[model samples]
Target: MNTSSEPGDSLEKQAGISLREARQTQLLKVFLVMSVIYTLYLAKTLFIPLVFSAFVALLLSPLVALGRKIYIPRTISAFVLIGLLIAPFSFLGVELVKPAERWMETLPKISAQITEQINEISEKFEQEQNQAEIQAEAERKQKEAEEASFFDNWFKDDEPEAKVEEVKEVKENVVTGQIKQGSIEIFLSLLASAPFLIAQMFGSVILILFLLIFGPVLFKIFIQDFPVVVDKERTVQLVGQIQKRLSNYIITISMINGLLGIATATAFYFLGVEDAILWGALVGMLNFVPYLGGLISCTILLMVGVVQYGLVSAAFLPPAVFLGINILESQFITPAVLGQSFRLNPLIIILWLAVMGWLWGVIGVLLAVPILVCIKIILEHLDVLPHWVKLLESEG
Candidate 1:
């Protein structure tokens, strides 16, 4: 034992730990750098016109190139594409406003319906809690209702009136506390911001239009002199792949979203819902977001349905419809079309929506996934990035 190389073993262990610690430190440094870069990108977004221009340019670049192939002038091709894209939305808004305004008046009733459905869910939960306490009582007779998990723990359909009443009393406060949507100040604030909001609206549209026109030319100029590579060939290749991938993504998403809108509109029409067209259009537009967008569409529809139907029984329609649509989209369309395309995990996508929704509101949520995908794509192609770095950026 005295002759054992104890000191050598200790040294080896120490060395290994030191190496691991150093590697960890290096990783932390890298994380810090990446965070700073993303922060810069977020800051740069206030100048969103430039970003919009880039995406538009990428989307139209292929078409513009095709135009050149057939001897069409690049400038003319850009203008034609912009007109084709912008004209539809412009027409839709003009026609849609009258119907949309008529529907807006139902907002209060819709909100009340949503509150009622929530109350039902809360009662069901309270009954379950009451059943659990009965089960825990030592003197209570062994009953069938006493056994179950949390879902069971909180939702026993059968419970004594006394027990149910007790549970109801406790949960009344808890349930009421959860019903926080808006205060007077929040509504007032929104009303106050209406002018600035209107200006931002026009600014965003004008920004989008400008991007559509000169986006490609700007892209060419931006990449013409890259700091990373000296050879023009590699640089051109990089730019081409980026444009192609982005354009392909956009075109595919647009087609899918359009179909979704049509499908949703058709379903709502059959359901005898009011303003079905507007709701469907909303669903279709939001459908671009994958899992999270679908949820929002479902929530809005549920609220409207609950408001219209005005009963616990009627409230079930929204979730039922939601489940069916999700089943079809997830089991079929997503796997077949958008599977490898998004590659990002559903949870991450949800989180991205939530974060963006918080920072930039609805527009933020709308743009989050696309922006994230773009960032992932760019990071993926960066040669200097490590495997782990690439892995994080990769679609799931």
Candidate 2:
């Protein structure tokens, strides 16, 4: 009866119901997402390795496919590929140990040099302060004399001589015993944890190997099990595109970083910096991290420069050269190679780095960009979140 009596009232009621349902759906989605994020944070120890393995599998998928085309067994191909990837890094680690130790030994001397420089600067500042005080006192006395009349000057009491106090140095004795004990404890803790860390590393390596070998099969099963609402052909195409694009991005970026590292090492060698190769390798690896990487590379270079060259203007050369190279690479080479499609908003990248870095420390920072890239790809393919996907992209 009411529907027949008033069409507008019924339409308004339907609209209100639809609006409430839509809002409820959105709120549920938001709650579910927050729950997932909290779970990820809580389970990071278990999840980080799995996530890393997935990315590593994605990176190696193309090579594994090529191996299949050549009739090579997946197991054999995965082993060979993983070995090829790990060998150089293992060798680099070994080679870097001696240099790292040498630098560690020199740390005391470097500290002393820095302390001396600070003392010199403080002394200069003190001298300047003293000179300013003397000038100010003279001006004050002059003003007093000028302000006084002839009779007033005669009647004024004799001014006493100003006394300057000598600055006293305080020397406190540090308890070396406690310091040594603390260092020993730290060393012992690290030694105790070494086995666990090694085990975890091996576990990750094994996981990565298995994933590389069976990733395609796992993907196929996932596709089969996907909801019927999602078009199977579109899902397959999306997965393929993600694999190809992500692998290509990783490979291209690695080559660029390698070139940058080589150039940096060569420059450092020519400049007579110690542990050039180690620093170069570190720079290259850290370059995987976005903005923070360049800053870290510059800082390390600057420290090396100061230690070697003793704080001269030339001491800045290494960091300057590094920063220049990084600018060239990040601004021109990287953008040109990655193209517009791969470009990401810097703000989002930094935020992603901060979150992941907080969750998993350095490893998370290293994985942040790749993880973000993968997420961006998935979001782009999902028609439901076009706005979120657009937010991840570069503005221009």
Output the number of the TM-score-best candidate: 2
- Give the best candidate by lDDT: 2
- Tens-digit lDDT track of model 2 for 1-396: 876868888789999999999999999999999998888888988888898878778889788989999999999999999999889889988999899767655555565566566556776786677778777877776688899787776776543223332331221113333444555565567668779777777888999898888878977887888576378888788878988888888889899999999889998899888789998998999999999999988898887887888768988999998888889999899989899878788899999999999888778999999889888887877765888888889574
TM per candidate: 0.68, 0.80
> Please, what is the whole-model Cα lDDT of each candidate in the order they appear?
0.68, 0.82
Tens-digit lDDT string for candidate 1 (218-275)? 7667667655556767767876776777777777778877776777667778877767
Residue pairs in candidate 2 whose N, alpha carbon or C atoms collide under 3 angstroms: none
RMSD of every prediction = 10.2, 5.9
- In candidate 2, position 55 carries an lDDT of 79
lDDT of 2 at 40: 82
Alpha-carbon runs more than 4 Å astray in model 1: 1-47, 109-198, 204-215, 218-228, 339-341, 383-386, 389-396
Candidate 1, after superposition: displacement of residue 67 in Å?
A: 2.5
